[model samples]
Structure formats: C-alpha cells, structure tokens
Target: MERFIEEELAIAKSVDLCAVAEYLGYTIRRVGKYYTIKEMDSIRIYSRSHWFRWSRQYEKGENGGSQIDFMRVFAGMEVKEAVFWLLDFAGYRRIEEPENRIVLKNQVVDKQEEKKTFILPVAAGSNTYLISYLNQERAISKVIIDYFIKKELIYEARGYHNIVFKGNDKAGITRFASMRGVFDKEGRAFKCDVAGNDKRYGFNDVNENSDVLVVFESAIDLMSYMDICADYESNKLALGMLSDAPLETFLTEHPQIVTLRFCLDNDEPGRKAAVELMEKYYQNGYEVEDCPPPVGYKDYNEWLKATKLLQRVPEEKAVMKSAHGMAK
Candidate 1:
C-alpha cells in the first residue's frame, strides 16, 4: 500500500493532484500529506489529543513504519488490515513470486493530462496582434455609437460609459471599440468597425408617452437625426433596429405604430431593407417616410459632419472604412 501511494504521488506532480484525490474519495490536503515535496522531510502529525491516545495505542513502526499510524489507531484496524484497505483504495493486487518466495505488486494506471486554454489575438498595431475576419469590436465608435447616444434613438442604460475624445480626460469611455470611429474633422463613417448593434437600439421609451414612433436602421443615423430635431418633443418616439432582425421584430411587435420614419443608411442594403419594410408595413395601416441623406455623403454621419451638427473630426485624416461597414 505504501508503494502504491508513492507511485500515485509521483504521477500527481505531472497531473492534477486535487483531481486524483477526488477520484480516490479523499480530500486533496489529506492525500497530499502522504507525499513530501522534498525527500528526507519528516511527515507532520495531524493531531495529538489525550482522549484519542487513551482510546488506542499506536506504535509508530507497527503499521509498516507508515505515517498513518494515527489512522490505524483511530480505525481500530491491525497493521495488515490497514495495509489491505489502503491497497484496495488504490486498486492494487498482490502476487506471489514463482519458485522461491518473493512478493509482487500490480496497479492500474488510467489517467490523462488536461489541455491548455485558447487565447485570442490583440488588435492591429499591437505587438501581439493577429487578424480576424470579424471586427465587431470596432463598431462601438463608428458614427453610429455617438449617433445613438446623442439622438436618444436607443434606450441608453443608466450608468453606461461615455465616449472619450483624445484631448479630454474628463470624458469616461466604456466602449472599447470607440477607437474605430476616430475620424478627421469631418463626421464621415470610416472604414473602421461600424457594422453592429447597440444595447438601446430597437427599444421603446415608455416614459415619453407617445404613440408616433420614429424608426432607423442603424444607431448612428438615428442619433444624427435626433440632434437635427432636438426641439421636437412628445407623441414622437425613437426606434433603432440594431440590425435587420431587430427591425423585423420591431415591425412585427408594433404593427399598430402608424408613423415610422425610416432613416437608414444610404447604401444599397439599407435602401433595399427600407423599401421592403415600407412595402410590407406601410400597406398594413402604417405611415412610412424615408429620410434620405442630403447628398455627397454615404450616411447620416457624413451629412452631420458636413452640416457641423456635431463635433468636428480632423479634415486631413481619413475615416476608417472598417468602422463604417465599407471595408471588405
């Protein structure tokens, strides 16, 4: 039994000792006590109580010189019986040598080491950066994020982090993707990661108490328009379909919302979605209106920049195509 315990302890250094202990139906700390990290280290006794000593008389070497003499004393088992029990715990078997009289031992080995965990790559310009097809992280700062926040087009969560400008230390930033929207003095949706959803998009504001709803395909466009009409209040509510799915869900849920202002992106997909929505919902007792871009700009962000409706980006810099869903 002592021999088997030593073998198991050796295997545990390479594997998970805690797991092995659990498999053997013993606590990890209790099992670990049998093995010393360094050879020649004396084993530490678990406890020394007068009552326990009086109950059983344990001579150290009686149990084959094992440190578990205390266990034998407590269990009221003879040295041979205790050894048998320990061997049974380790699933070992004893065999007699052939001709003369030698003893042999056998034990089963059934364990495999666990694998390591996977790690993701860092973004561009990072020393450890690698490429990924999906740049969802970049979508946060695209004109859409600001538009959503400014226009109140979506239900901004209370205590949500604010976007930070380069020069301002006061502005708090929660969105890790805001760097993608970094543009020149112009408000154009750049090639950064602009294609994605916001939490508040496609949500209704109950406290506003309005029957008329304003819907937009993307968050930025909705927000740009919100700044354009800050004075208008009441009866009008904003709806941002984070994507095509939410747009469909919104239309299905609010079939009775009569007025839907479609302020989608000026691109082909956006225009197609708007036309499809108009055909489907407008005929079903709904009033649909298209808010086309003012021209020379691909989206509301560009128009807003052109009109100086929001903060000006650098004029010399280029808007990231990846941020604006224009990247391949």
Candidate 2:
C-alpha cells in the first residue's frame, strides 16, 4: 500500500493535465494560453505554462487549484483516489499534435506564463456620482436608487466615477463587482465585470416580509423594475446578477422565496438563461416564471425609457451638464 501510494503520488506530480481531461471525456471548447475544459464550465487551466496552476473562469469564486485539485473537483473523487487515478493518465498526451486536438480554433500556440488578478478600483467620496448618473441620466427612480445606495449595494469609484455594483457573500463581503463607467471609460463599451467576484454572492435586495423574488441580468434593469413597479410590491426581493452566472446561487440562497420571477433581458441569451433558470427552479418544487423585457425593448432599462412615465434618461448631452455626466 505504501509503495503504491508513493508511486501514485510521483505520477500525479508530473501528469499531463490536458491529456487526462481529454481522455476522461473533457473536450477542449476554448484553447489558448488558458484552456477551458468542458467538465468545468467556468474554470480555465493554464496549460503549457505553469506546472499545475489553474485559475477559476469566474472572477469572484475560488474555483481553482493545482492539477490534483482539478481531478478532485471535476471527477468528484477523494485526494488519494484522484492521485491514484491520475497516475494512470500521467503520460496520456503531449503539447504537440495540435493538428489533431484543441479543436474549435486553429490559433497557433507560443507557450508562455500568464496570470489573472482582480483589483477593485477605489471608491469615490460618496454615492453622489452614481446617484446622479442613474437618476438624472438613466431615468431610474430616485427613491429606488436611494434605497439601494442606503443599503450599500452600489457606489461610485474614485478615479473613474464609475458605477460599482457589488455581489456580496453571506458575511456581507463584496465577492463580485460589476462596474460601468459613468464617465472617462476605456473599453468594453463602458462596462466591465471585475475579476475575483463570486457569483454565489450575486447582488441581492432581500425583504424578509416578501416571498416574491424578481431576478434581472443587470443592475440598471433591476432598478428599472423597481421603478416601474414602485406603485406596489415594494417589499418584493430583487436580485441583480450582473450576469446569468449568479442565478443559481441567488435562488439557492433564498429557498424561502415562493415565487421566482426571471426578469431577464429580451434578447436570445437573456431568454435562454431565463428559460433554463425557470426550469431548474420549477423542478425544485418552486413556482418559477420567466418574464423577459417587454416586446420591442432589449432590456428593462430600455423599456423604462420608452414608457416616459418614470424619471427618463435625458435624450441629449444637455443633461450631462452635471459633474456626474451621461453615457451618450
């Protein structure tokens, strides 16, 4: 037993991670300096670079570790069991033979080390910048915006004056953050999902008195829903996932929620996610429904704009006439 364990340990220490994954039915969906394995949806393995350092495809969650950890996580096996199993596939494949492998793309490879890290920008003096942008420019209701700000869910970054929407854990620590530039934006269409955010801690506004939970794809949409429905149902809980990644986590965290309303975007991806999440929760014995953004509108924010009943986004830069400024 001791000799077997020692041998397995030695083999696991120098196993070919990519080959093992391929042999075990994990197809490489996206390959590059980082390889995205099918088995782990949001986990990227840094192949041909570091010894066994992999990073979570997710920015907020800690879903990363060494090759051994990869086996344990994806295979659902114990440490010793993984070590033993990996030994058999240690010499499974090699870095060459790209012609026959790493499908879906024909990009050439020059093996080099790369690392990803998440560092949240500094917060500005107060929520003044964000409040002005969302209320005056975006047309989101002041009452709804003020409510979230008071709850500490949204803020403004110091240098950029961007809007920072937080995904917080049970302990109230900011695990994930979604940032959109209110001014002085650089790239990605004025939006960025900062790394190191745990989707499990997706943005939530819970009202213990209410059993209905409405979910949205972005923070602006969430606030828009609240704005439109401000006449009633103020107690309904709202969750802004920043993306669909946190839908499961948010649902899981709120089992007491009897009604799950997916108020996602109206586009293909949004409808797809809403359908999936609705089915998943409905199967779990909860009442689930997907109410996508109204027809002729791409998102709730847009829908809100067309209504003109609520505080509407300014049609011109005449509104950016404030220190907070406007998107257009």
Candidate 3:
C-alpha cells in the first residue's frame, strides 16, 4: 500500500493544472502567484509551480494537491480515475491503472467558504504576437484564429505576449482565464490562472441544440483539428478541456449529447483516458470513438505540420518544373 501511495503521489505531482483546466474546459486567469476562475471564488489554484505539479489554496478552506486532487475535489472523481486521468493528461505513457485499484474516500469540502470574484488580466494592445505564434509556429488557419479572437474566446494579454483563453458563463460574465506563454522553447512553458476562480465556467463551443460533443485536451489541439476539418457544423459542439474535470458536467448539462468523440493526444495516457470515457459513456448508450493523431504522429499539431510541409513540397516542385519548361 505504501508503494502504491508513493507511486500515485508521483503521478499527481506530474499533472499540469493549466493543461488540466484546458482539458477540463475551465477558464483560468493568472496574476502572479494566484489563479482564479469566474464560477468559483474562495478557491484559487496556486499559480507558481513547475510543469511537474501545481498547488491550490482556498481562502475559506484548505484541500489541495496537483491535477489529481483537482479532479477529486472539483469533479468528485475517484482516486483511481483521477490518477488515471492526470497521468494521461501528462502523457505519462507508462502509468496505468491497476486491475484491482484501491478505492479512497472522497475529499471533504468546506461549506463555509465565501465566494470570490475572478478577474481577467489587463488586455494587450494587439494580438500581434498571438497571431504570429498561432499562425506561423503552430500553423493554424488565420480565419479560424480570427474567429476565436472575434468571438472574444481568446486574446493577447497585456504586459506579456502570453495568450488568454477566456471562459464565460451563461449570463456572459467572464469567469475563467487561462494564460499561456508563446515563448516556450521545447521545455517547460510559462502559464497560470487568475486567482479566486470557479470551475463551473469553461472555454467551450457547446451548442445547446447540438447532439454531438467533441472533446480535446487543449484549445490548440481542438483548433488544429478544426483546421484539418474545415467544414463547420452548428449542431456539433467542440469543447476543449484544460483538464477532464468538466467532462461530466458538460455531459450533464447537455442531455442531447448522443455522440461523444475524444480527440486527445496520441500517447498512452491520452488513449487510456479515451478508452475509459468510451466504456463509461458507451454503457450509458452513447456512441463513442477515440480519435487520436494519424499513426506515427504525436498530435494534431504534428500531423498538421507534416501535412503542410508535404503540401509546400508539391507546390515548390511545380514551380521548379514551370521554370525549367520556360527555359526550354
């Protein structure tokens, strides 16, 4: 049991809360060491941390850990599922749930905590950096990117070149903010959420009248897939979870969700999470499919990169041929 505990704790420390938020579909904003959401005040996910783990503190109470505990407290997920989801979220390909998983009691919530308000970061002058990063480096379509900016779903934050992903409630109040640095260099990234946040709000494209729900781990992944499949469908909702915490809630709110598709990363944890969700929802009579990247690809972004490269190559060869024919 000690070994199990140690191992599980290690996995918890590895979960990325921001990624979890994006995967779970929560809106988070960061201002220094605090991350707050719109829906849940008193609770703030601590912003200062490495990629290996995250910490949370409640103004009215105390109950915190990394992504694992976030899922447990926020989503009421069991320890096994929480750990499994976190491990997968981290792309910890080797971490697997044991056949006979240990069941732990649920986290105790503090009822007396006062609600708090979430604030968005000061807005930037322009999305120059945001546009460049998503378009040139990430290769996303400008039209699609413009749509998000136009919809106010994302923007460039003031003071830094970080990108802001906003989460708004039904009343249209901005509740969650997740900011990510555009300066990552193949290592750890700079990101955080605003303090005093609520988990109820998310960066979603859910259609009340739609019957299909497409889930992804991050907004970039969701948008990348959107770039690949350019056709639009209003009856289909595309929701990206910063973590999987919001999966259950989104489904609950949308009883019309009959077809569930997971477009998570192609790693082991991503696949594991997809399978688990499929089995759980399949039993509930939902049509489910695991849609990872094409074989040998790590993610939609990678696939997009390769596809774009191939396309350019053909065009370049065509140009070369035309020049040669003209010379003849």
Candidate 4:
C-alpha cells in the first residue's frame, strides 16, 4: 500500500490529479484514505486534506524539505510507507536518504520542454490555405465535390478561387466539414498549405428568430445536408460547432436564438460538448435535435461517401426528393 501511494503520487505529479482522477474513475480523496500505509522517514500520518494543502503551499518552488516531509505532508503517507512508495514509484530498490532525491526533481522540467515542440493547437476561423491546392478543372474529378455540386450541396463560385458553399440555401439545417488550413482574425485567408489538424475553419448562418435551427458536427456534413435539401428550398440551413464561438458572439450581441438541432459528432468529445452546449443554451429556449450518423459511421460525410448514393441525386428538386426517399 505504501508502494502504491508513492507510485500514485508520481503519476499524479507527472500528470494532474484531476486528469488522473478522470482516467481512473476514482477521486483523490478516496484514494488517499484507502491506500496509505506508514511513512519511513517522518513517522507522521498525513491526512488527505493536509496533503493537498501542502501541495498548494509548496506549489511554486520551495526546497530544503525532507523526503518524509514531502511524502507525509504532500503525499498523505506515513514515513515507513513513503520510503517504500518512493522506491516503488521511482523504480528504485531503496533509498538511503531523502534529501538527495530533491536534486533529481528537475527531470520532469526537461520532459516538459520536450513535449512543447510536439503538440500544437488547432487553428480556428477561416481556412483559405486550401486555395493553392484547388484545381478548378480537376475539382470535378473529386467524387465528393461532384456529389455536392450535382445535388446543389454547394453552389458554383466562378471567382472565389476555390469551391465555396453558401449558407442561405436552407432552414433549420446543421453542417460540417473536415477543412484544413489556417485563417486570420478577421475571418479571411492567411496561408495555403496541406490539410492538417493544425488549423480549422468554422461558420454559422442560423437566424436567431427562427423557430428551429440545425447544427451539424462538420462542414462537410453540413454541405452534404445542404445538397440534400437543395431542391426542397424550405429545408434547414445547418451550422457547425466550429462556428460555435461566432454564433455565440452573434447571439449575445444581437437576437437570442431559440430552437436548435444539434447534429453532434458521434465521438466522445462531440457528445460531451453537445451535452454542455445543450445545458448552456437549452434554458434560453434553444431546443437541440440529435442527428446521429448511420451505424458504423461517425458522421454523415462518411455515410454519404461509403454509400455512394449521391450519384443518384438529379439536378431537379422533385426528382432528388424521390431519389433521396428511395435511397433512405
């Protein structure tokens, strides 16, 4: 048990206690009370609350603390237990003294420096970087592009440089896309590059006064839905959560939207965010609808691509509806 405390403390310090708690499905408070044994160095039995207090107290940088002081006060372990815990957590057989271990604490700092170069935040807002890669002539060859165009999922923009979709074509719609590239603060082009999670773009076209507004998980899915409703004319115009900040800003500054249909991502993050968004906006009269993708697919884009039924959508509205119903 003492060994467990040391190992757990090492992990807790390496990551945050909150993250560990989330992953382990156990609380720090409960773990402290159940697993702690005796401390070898301090001969003190530290309580859970006191350990947390010590963590907060010595948080920034403080030295000259004994090994027992750290384990008993900070880790909530007894002295005999702290020794074994440290040994087990550090993967060492034993420790003759506690103060020597203090000098080795800088290792985590080095690891932090290493991680800094690997991870980067995803870019938000407009992505015009794909412009250079756009081959208008070859775009027709891309099956996805052709599918949307044929179904009016996207309108042909002769001068926009790349294919652009309009949000005004439908009502109560949600949309999505796996767009790549980066954008500027003013919601305009910044650079052109290959697609990556490095950057992203999002937008919204829902009216606040509307009784129903649909939100899609990705821009591609939104476009697919738009193409599906191209003939209907009165169908919903979907927005993506990538557009959430913008939509919230718009709603806050102007009219408050009411009904909302959230076509959330089937993944964990999307589902969690959907719940949070629903909680945040539901009281404001914004009703959310869940448009889950078909079984075995995470979203509608995949559904459309896998099924290859977009080829059947004729340019005419009535014909498209008939085809869509039949395909479904």
- Candidate topping lDDT: 3
TM-score of each: 0.34, 0.54, 0.61, 0.35
CA lDDT, every prediction? 0.38, 0.64, 0.67, 0.41
Q: Which 10 residues in a row give candidate 3 its minimum summed lDDT?
A: 48-57
The runs of at least 3 residues in candidate 3 whose Cα sits more than 4 Å from the true structure, single-residue gaps closed, are 1-116, 234-243, 324-328
Q: lDDT tens string, model 4, 1-328?
A: 3444443443223322222122334333334443222322222222221222332445542221333345564457776675555333322233245544556544555343232231222322222322322222112124445444455434322211223443321241323222222111112221221222212223334444455556675555664454444423212433444346634543554344556666667778777877877777877676666666766777666665554445534446678788899999
Could you give me the TM-score of model 1 versus the true structure?
A: 0.34
Q: C-alpha displacement of 141 in model 1, angstroms?
A: 15
Candidate 3 to truth, TM: 0.61
Q: Mind giving the per-residue lDDT tens digits that candidate 1 earns over 33-85?
A: 34321221232222111111211235434322232342364456765565555
* Model 4 clash number: 32
The sequence of per-residue lDDT tens digits that candidate 2 reaches over residues 1-328 is: 2434343454455544555576678886656567776655555656421123245445332366655676776678877777666543332111233445546577777876554465776877788768877976667878888888888888888744668888765566777787775532111125556665555556667665567778877778878888877724522333444344565565566556788787888888788877887887788887887787778999988888777643334643445666346443
Query: What residue runs in model 1 are displaced by over 4 Å at the alpha carbon?
Result: 1-208, 231-243, 251-256, 309-328
Answer with 1 or 4, whichever has the higher TM-score: 4
